[model samples]
Target: MPRFSSDGVDIAYFDEGAGDPVLLIHGFASTKEINWVNPSWTKTLLGAGYRVIGFDHRGHGASQKLYDPELYHTRLMAEDACNLLAHLGLPRADVIGYSMGARVGAQMALLFPQAVRSLVMGGLGIHLVDGVGLPQTVADALEAPSLDDVPDAMGRTFRAFADANKADLKALAACIRGSRQVLSREEVGRIFQPVLVAIGTRDSVSGAAAPLVELLPDGTQLDIPNREHNPAVGDKVFKEGALAFLKARP
Candidate 1:
């Protein structure tokens, strides 16, 4: 429930446990609780002797909501993560992010490498190199007055998820509107930190993880067979891979 100012917006975050810090950034339409706590990420990391830090991205969860499309750019969201680390007085910390959060983490590595010790990107893949894979219709779904009218199954699912989370639909639509910027291969190659890209083999939303891993200087991939985007959020394979990757980080 703690909050900090990130570029004048009050962002909510949680800090728990003790030892080396690991910052957890949730995906689109997700709060830290749904993305991290519900999956036992904090408990798992805490048991492993890590201090767990999780936060609600601006306009998501308990954070201040903004209707402006400009506020949701991936770069600004990455700044929020860096600001959180600074606010917590951690010079650098291991980071794990899923879906939209994965892109935010990638931006952090590209823009604020000094504050990141290692990176684990989940629910991301080749689509990351092009742009956010979801279409504008998906954003429309978030703003739709009723899910019954959303014809696309994917859009309906995302809209339903937003409704279940009681999210700010307008803010999420803006996030989708503004977060179209993509990471070039050269930009990804600039990330020299140990990195793990985890995705589900069946996740159509993410494309393939191999292309993304190939772009990272020290990247590796973990594919959770039979799982899809939402179900793959905190898969056991992802957790194990992340633990090992962080443990082996130089």
Candidate 2:
């Protein structure tokens, strides 16, 4: 397992193929293997002649997990990504991020515009700025002893998220509650790179991908009918649409 130091944390990442670089950022409570490799996203992009790089975010996967709430901020996550790219000697590369990763990607493009060649944002919407409504009750639940009594209402509330299993669900809910900061739309608009925003029509979290579509200065939106967030990554419609859009751009 390859690793690097960034933002006072040790990060784990995977590098494969040999062509125009494309970085893959996984979602909350998801590792690079679960999001990209397990879905064969790396194979799809690599088969199309693009190099693929993926990493596990802090507090998830093989990366160092600090139980500290402050360390999981989106800004720090963004900085970790930027620092990783710099450490690898990559001045610029295409970025593909999903869910929480998309939020981080947005910050990356905003804070380090020159370091990003293009963007493919999946499973997220303008709610990053409009707000996703993480309440204090949810925050308290994260620190609760044993989630055996976790309410069904809370589970139903986050059903749109990928992992539906109890442990995965609890951990994800905790992460969201612990790290609740909104991304700025004004900052999102500042990104000038060609962006491909793909959303699953059935996506529970980012249901209104249209609003996010409108925010991008230069973006193409694709809505995959009958698909949910996790499945969309492997959906033929989604993959082809993104590849075509990326290939057409400089």
Candidate 3:
């Protein structure tokens, strides 16, 4: 229920436990409680003797919502995160991000490298900006409300996407069309911190994790066989791997 004002917007966040801080950023359409709390991430990290801080991104969860397309840019999202860390009075903290949150985390590390101690990026890839492997028509259909009216698999998919009220889906679709700027391999190489990139082996949208593994300066990759994007994070295999990678860091 704790909240703070960042970039003139009221942001909702959860702060729990005590130790070196570990910030958790959830993906698009996922609230802090839905993504990290329900998944036991907060408990797991807390039990490991780390303080966990999670917040609802602007336009998502309990944070301020903006219908304007320009407000949803990755840069703005990153700034919101920076403000949160500053509000907490912490100069640096470990960052763990998933999916859309992963993109924001990467941008934060690039823009404020000193504020980040280590990075754990999951459910994402270097080419996240490249249309996310969805067909152009399917992507377009996500914005067209008439498309949302249809019934069937396509309708379900569109509804799922439109449900992420964090910055209008229409605006997000437009951003994708205009910039196509997800993350890039070059940017991955530029990350100088110790890094861990975890992926579900069966993840279709993010593609293979090998490409990301090869790009990091100091990186380790963990693949959860037979797991999909959402399930991979909770898998014992992933938890063990992630904890090991994070603890290995100084």
Full-model lDDT for every candidate: 0.90, 0.77, 0.74
Query: What digit string (tens of lDDT, one per residue) describes model 2 on residues 1-250?
Result: 8899995689999889988989988887668988898878899999999988999888777787666566777878888888888888888889999888888888788888987898888887776678653455554454455455446555433442333423344444456665677767777778889988888999876647778778779877888889987677678887788789879989
By TM-score rank, best first, the candidates go 1, 2, 3
Clashing pairs in 1: none
Q: Whose TM-score is greatest here?
A: 1
Candidate 1: tens digits of C-alpha lDDT, residues 106-219 = 889889999899999999887778756568998999888799989988889889999998899999898888877788889888999888999998998987899889888899
Candidate 2 or 3, higher lDDT?
A: 2
Task: Please identify model 1 stretches exceeding 4 Å from their true place.
Answer: none
The best candidate by lDDT is 1
Candidate with better TM-score, 2 vs 3: 2
Clashing pairs in 3: 59-166, 129-182
117 in model 2: Cα distance from truth in Å?
Answer: 0.8
Query: Clashes per prediction?
Result: 0, 0, 2
Which pairs of residues collide in candidate 2?
A: none
Q: Please estimate how well model 2 matches the true structure, expressed as its whole-model Cα lDDT.
A: 0.77
